[model samples]
Target chain A: MSSKKQASSQLRVGDNPLVKWLLVGLTLFLTAILLVVPLIAIFQQAFVEGAAHYFNSLLEADTLHAIGLTLLVAALTVPVNLVFGVMLAWSVTRFEFPGRKLLMTLMDIPFAVSPVVAGLLYLLLYGNNGWIGAWLYEQDIQLMFAWPGIVMVTVFVTCPFVARELIPLMQQQGREDEEAAVILGASGWQLFRRVTLPNIKWALIYGVILTNARAVGEFGAVSVVSGNIRGETNTLPLHVQLQYEDYQAAAAFASASLLAFIALLTLLFKAFIEWRQERQEATL
Target chain B: MSILIEHISKTFGQFQALSPLSLDIQEGEMIGLLGPSGSGKTTLLRIIAGLEGADTGRIQFGDRDVTNLHVRDRRVGFVFQNYALFRHMTVADNVAFGLDVLPRKERPSPSEIKKRVMHLLDMVQLAHLANRFPSQLSGGQKQRIALARALATQPEVLLLDEPFGALDAKVRKELRRWLRGLHEELGFTSVFVTHDQEEALELSDRVVVMSNGYIEQVDKPGDLYASPNSRFVFDFLGNANVFEGKADQGKWLNQQASLQLPKGIEQQDGQLYVRSHEFFVSDAPTEQANLPLKVVAINPIGAEVRLELSPIGWQSKDIWEIDLPHKAFDQHGYEKGQTVFVTPKAGYFFADDLAQPTPLHW
Candidate 1:
């Protein structure tokens, strides 16, 4: 026992034994340089005037309107995308039909296409003098350079985020559970509600949170369509860009800090879900 | 009246899964559909469970023609090989799921549903795991919960596909007996599919042997083992020594060896299969009436001895297997690479149908 203890003590740091701490030290060093320094810099730059001035600047009329529009767009886009994402995941995973592969490829088009290019495609379809735009303008149904146009572009740009997260998850959880429920005399609706929904609920919620974050931060696509009407169409990202152009750096960072806080909350929620799943697995 | 299938045929694209199959299952009879992989046993069970449809067939359950009925309307319970329990729901909720589907007027109250779920959990010996999720249970526990869930709705027929195939050897044996006891107690009309013949012969009241999309034979376990109808059925059910020999007036000769075939065999140029246990090895000249064999290898299993034997010119030929009781081997004291005389009692003979050439392969 004494020999074992002495050997263990000798095998500690700088003992030149088989075990080494070089990898751990290198990882920590890299993370501090690559991530922590920049985050600290951003926080210091944003909070230079402390909470008093920061709160006052955020409460300004234009800035407040921009934040409200950003939230409204996210609230509209997240739930809509959640429902469509689940439906799309179900169809792409469970069924076999003509154009199935094409549908799968089309779901990823949003990720591959640039945000500016996406806004341009909708402009081609709904802008005045465009194919569908001429007929729409005749009936006084405006889309481009309006609230509807901003939402349309935002949906196009962030459409795949939710569905993409759900497809692989739904595919891994195949028809087994649903079939078991049906064998238990469950109706289609009951099976979806009780058995199917509970299994994919976490992934679906994570996808919605991420989609909301993406929707709030989107600037190029929304700016192309919003026309930057200060109080009406300007969302948080556009408002920040406008502030930077007007040389109001402190106010821009202050608003950017709010978006950053939301992003941090989303990350925390995702990490909590993953940690819970891991804990459950460890118990099993 | 129970369930009757008439002339069922199914094909997935170009591959035929089942071909004009017909079977009848009696009420409260626990029958097993025994076959290897891709032998259409699972397909037949799926068709009966309403999980799959036969291309051209009529299924009658009592007086109802349920061939085209939806799965939810069939009222049949199916247990998958993997158990297929919902990983998110607790054990009680998984069992009470079917009870929750009844109409409001006909449905049981929440407390009543709880009592029924508890009763089901007790039946499967899983009452202690009532609140645990499926991922939290062992394989045996999951299977028990799946069985309880299947029985929850009081289904007319229960179908299981390789119920214990995924379990360890010891667990599989224990569950086989447990399942048998459960069937005896509940008297459910069950059809279980498995590739293991021992499992089929042990658990089932009657076994249906299938191969290549067609059922070759169906009979009681003891009778099916003593006498199989075809070479495929015989070889698949157990180990056998198959010989392709010619008949000359009165005696059958081995194809490439000098040993005379067993007496009382039919005078036909066909294949003959004899169970390994039916033949006994003895010293040369000790039994003049027995056929001479050269023992090539000896492998001792639990209580039996597997002997790989060869005839006179057995160098370039099929090897014959012989299984002897450990007591018999110890009593005779026959060592490997020694000459021995063997005799097999005449039981059955069948022509090999797999010898036929396929047009598609050509």
Candidate 2:
């Protein structure tokens, strides 16, 4: 016991300069090999054929169509998720009801399941030979191997983002302020619009950013559901895969670089938001 | 307007929060619900504010039944213990919230709202900090803003649940005086809940003493203190010394002490309750003396000295606390371990013991 106490007392930062330097060196070495090297390689490969060739490759009809389709899919998915997230979070946090824990667990199911499994689940429910698919086919409505299928898979993969961001925040805020508003003669909708919405706006924006990023970058689920149809169902990530398969290395790297750029932009935006939130909270 | 509560009772699952209770407040009266924690004071206050519905009750605001009305329509301003001010809004905006959230047809224009908010801020002495957020204000300032916001709608009745319970000692005293003054000038009927006996007695026109989900007594502060109706009220309202003894004929006797009972008292197990200041200590034993006690501890509070006394050679659980004024303490020169005979100047007795009482004063 005395020896343990002595060891704990001696365990201060910078106690062993050599060990600290070794750990720092190891961390940098691993980060360079794992992250920095691959990022540099992707940019290098994309620009190998020159900037003109790279820009031309991206301006191709099928690639432009894919980019437009990805944007369309994100546009449809992110808003739906945003609305659903706010409603679910509000209901779960503000009210007492039976099966609340079960509802929260169900909301988290998509996050726990593999993306490929999520895609396959949707496929089994909406594929041509599937139950719903056959009925829709009789009505001349095509859902499988189409843009709708791609959008559905993307929504499933990104559905939990906004609600996950908001549930804890609304719960922490509690019902006191809203109750105070109600007692102050604010109507139901007015309480929500004036009091609740402003409080959760930051978390809502953060959730939307995450959901949009996931919807734009989703590959596994969209591939399984979209059936890899070039220019029609292929999103940006799928287009990159198709370009690589055709042995067009320059085209593939150019498309991949676009995704990398988006991801980087998302990181920067998230960091800026987090910094702003921290400053606001400090004043609070 | 006066408020009336009739047969109000509440139960959460199997726990009985409040038994059948009724209270009436005259117009412009400042009443306090005084009790310890879980005594249903807050629950009763919330029911009055229309925030929580009583299981079986009818509430009326000057004969207009408000039992079924929503909180917004109740027009009763409520100040919570935590202040509940909107953190994102400035003090002026928070005060203006009630006016801003009114229905479009009833809503005031923006400039009118600013003027009314500024006026209320000035009333609360927060006009200088109107631009500051609640997070930037001290606890007292935040509570003042809460009070200003609650009053912005000109509520007929105001309800506060431990309004000063969250503040420190000095701030609480100052705000208590300020609130009393505000209520007098505004002429709004208000009910506040608090566990601090001093706060309740100091600020209230009348106090409702409650215990175990039941109303013990309701009276003016001086009356409640001088003549408590139950053993619970006697103990809860002030410092008390309890002595357990058996009533035999016209005398109450126990293993360590005996006292002359009031005339014609029944023979039964009884407990005598004496307020700390109601006892006198004498150096010489007299006929009125009940027991010789050794002073175990002496605590000199601000204006009075509290003496903890135990009967000499007594192994029973009874220990008497005698409070003497500083002048009396100086004259008697009582010290720790000094022996003195104790006699009750005034006391009350419950013939059925402390648990369930049958009051017989002596």
Q: Write the per-residue lDDT of candidate 1 for residues B1-362, one digit (tens) a residue.
A: 38899999999989999999898889988888998899999899989888888999889988899998988888887889998887777889888888898768879999999999999898889999999988888888888888998888878788998999888888889989998998888877899999999999999989999988898999999988766767677779877776565666554456444334345444556555667886646665332233567889999988898888887643324688888898888888778889887766543555334432111100
Task: Show where candidate 1 strays beyond 4 Å.
Answer: A1-30, A49-51, B248-251, B254-256, B261-266, B283-297, B309-312, B315-319, B332-341, B351-362
- Colliding residue pairs in candidate 1: none
Candidate number achieving the greatest TM-score relative to the actual structure: 2
Q: What is the per-residue lDDT of model 1 for residues A89-155, given as tens digits with 9 covering 90 to 100?
A: 8888888888999999998888898898888888888998779998999999989987888888888
Clashes in candidate 1: how many?
0
**iRMSD for every model:** 1.5, 0.7
Over 4 Å off, model 2: A1-25, B248-254, B257-267, B282-297, B308-320, B327-342, B353-362
Task: Give residue B233's lDDT in candidate 2 (0 to 100).
Answer: 85
- List model 2 lDDT by residue over B23-43, tens digit each: 999999999999999999999
Cα lDDT for residue A208, candidate 2: 96
Question: Lowest-scoring 10 consecutive residues by lDDT in candidate 1 chain B?
Answer: B353-362
True contacts kept of 2: 0.87
